[model samples]
Target: MAHRPDTLEHAPLGRDSAYPEQYDAGLLYPIPRAANRAPLGIDDDKLPFVGEDEWHAFEVSWLNGRGKPIVAVARFRLPANSPNLIESKSWKLYLNSLNQTRFASREDVQRTLLRDLAAAAGGSVSVELLGVDDSELVPQRLPGECLDDLDIDVSDYTPSAAHLAVGEVIVEETLYSHLLKSNCPVTGQPDWGSVLIRYKGPKIDREGLLRYLIGYRQHQDFHEHCVEHIFTDLMQLAKPEELLVLARYVRRGGLDISPWRATPGLTPPSPLRLARQ
Candidate 1:
């Protein structure tokens, strides 16, 4: 309970591939879910891509069996660069598989969850059970300072109108998250999460940083792909001396995707809550 609900807590008919508003199939009230549908475009050659990466995760969730709805969060670490980046919707689907499971033991439940999610993700995942009674987990990193509490300003730059040429920015470790929740302009779904950005470069324009992030307000792509595109764009325009970009999402259907990218030699800082994977 130390984190948000694992159930699909969005307004029904949102943009998940299977349950879009277009489907008009009614809301997924009994706890919606997903997995592995996001990574489909990973190796697209048309995009002036950046680096390669691997994704690992340990996700957790379960049915109360007691008739009461219980929200669960599993915590685990992923390698900084594993070779298995997952497809997001597939992740939602995998987590939903647990919707009907009646866990007999918390330990057994945790073990099974880790195994299944890892397999579905095409990578290994870890699971740390956060009891059903726990309070929703909010970032311990901030409160009144949280971006969720602020009025955000949109970016002035156009993503389609690149900066003409590539540029780079370098800076010490710093992390930021926003609910600016943007979805694929094409699909119109909400992509939620707190993104962690760390790098050592010539220093990026903070406003530009904000603008660049806003550019994705209507952009469409998977969580991993989005981060990679951003990383690639910045390295070309800002030309950072060194950089690492990561996005750790809150669970959507008992599954969460945390994507990390670094320009070799730069060690991305791991949140104490995250696994060292």
Candidate 2:
């Protein structure tokens, strides 16, 4: 299988008196399929949130009959208040199941996944599926640039410093990005990749900004929710004149998802190209 949970250790999540690794089998990443998972933030738990932007994905998968990788690009939109939004862990588990699936055609795979993911998320999710030979339809450019992993240090906030309530940026009018590196709050297994944030408002404190991002260094949350939480934090804290927060995470189990959000009037920056691509 492209994604093998048996070999990949994970953080556990469930009810157990002994407090075992919070690993959730469903939270497995690098799904055998061409997919990825992203959570907004762990702190956004206290707020009411919804999916607002369009999700564009470029996926490469292999067919059971051909044994060659087939490429697909999907665009899914979730309602702001869609109930039963598939939790990150569960979503990963679901994608991994596709490994053994052999669809008659790419359309069948697209239709099935769109229907199933939408149903699991409790809202209509749109998907644009494409074969490897068809590449013209996917998004061409992305926002921001590749990050240099600034050797961030989080010694002070290492052991549960504080739950994420909100973040403050010390830098003024700047563009910053950090590769996303987090773990399952349960198992402590690391989830990785990059994140980009750009805004036109007063620049936030860089140190504070790093601290905010670092806060999640040890904390665990889904990629989609993490980005969303960051969006909410900016709206609540700095309230920049114009703001855009986007993260392009590396693929796990062959899947990756990028989430974006902004104020009603402001438009999000285009997706960017990073080394991982």
Candidate 3:
């Protein structure tokens, strides 16, 4: 098991806490990204990939000037270069605080959230607030070649970069699996997710890749960090000319995090919620 870094030592992840009915930005906690990236050979100054961490807040509510409650869903986009990553539990608490606050307009609420989230993320954060009636709420299946149907025997459950054996011919392929599971660095709670990998380079052995992804079953890390780790490992071991890695985790506390990392020039995939999310 990996040791929890000092940055997460003070987070409210595993701790019991009171929910604030009043608006309070103090509820937000930002953990430095360096702490987790260090082990993966990721340096903020010279990042090998460009991506964003997409977060969906399903239970957002606020009071209007008329004292009537307004409800909506929100999407937050935090750049990968952000110096800090907001802790999910604290993010939930912060959103809960807005339940009783009155906003002059929806734009006002969005601006406030954008500013606060950007500050917490240590980078510019984009926020989109939408009504529940929006058609985007529909769930969609992940796009790629499903690897879950591969009938293979598994023995090891720990992460291993060696599993990504390469073939002689270069190819372009997108592979996905719903078996990606890791634990919380602080609480040891299971974090279940599905991962998609698209690359244009030497072919990666399918069975080996599946085994490699499932290897994270006992690994402990955040969603964003885990995605980066996968990206870094593939770039180093598989030696792909182009690669993109994205992982979508199930909703826990009305929020689901999807982190993606891709080489320059590749457009990001659509931010669609999976069936399980």
CA RMSD, predictions in order: 9.5, 9.0, 3.3
Candidate 2 Cα RMSD after full superposition onto the native fold (Å): 9.0
lDDT of 3 by residue, 39-60 (tens): 7878888888999999999989
lDDT of 2 at 236: 63
Best by lDDT: 3
After TM-score superposition, what is the CA distance of residue 49 in candidate 3 from its true location, in Å? 0.6
Kindly provide the TM-score of model 2 when superposed on the true structure, using C-alpha atoms: 0.61
Give the least accurate 10-residue stretch of model 2, judged by summed lDDT: 31-40
The CA root-mean-square deviation of candidate 3, after full C-alpha superposition on the true structure, stands at 3.3
lDDT of model 2, residue 77: 58
Tell me each candidate's TM-score: 0.57, 0.61, 0.96
Model 3 segments more than 4 A misplaced: 1-6
Ranking by lDDT: 3, 2, 1
Worst 10 residues of 1 by lDDT: 23-32
lDDT of 2 at 26: 34
For candidate 2, what is the lDDT?
0.50
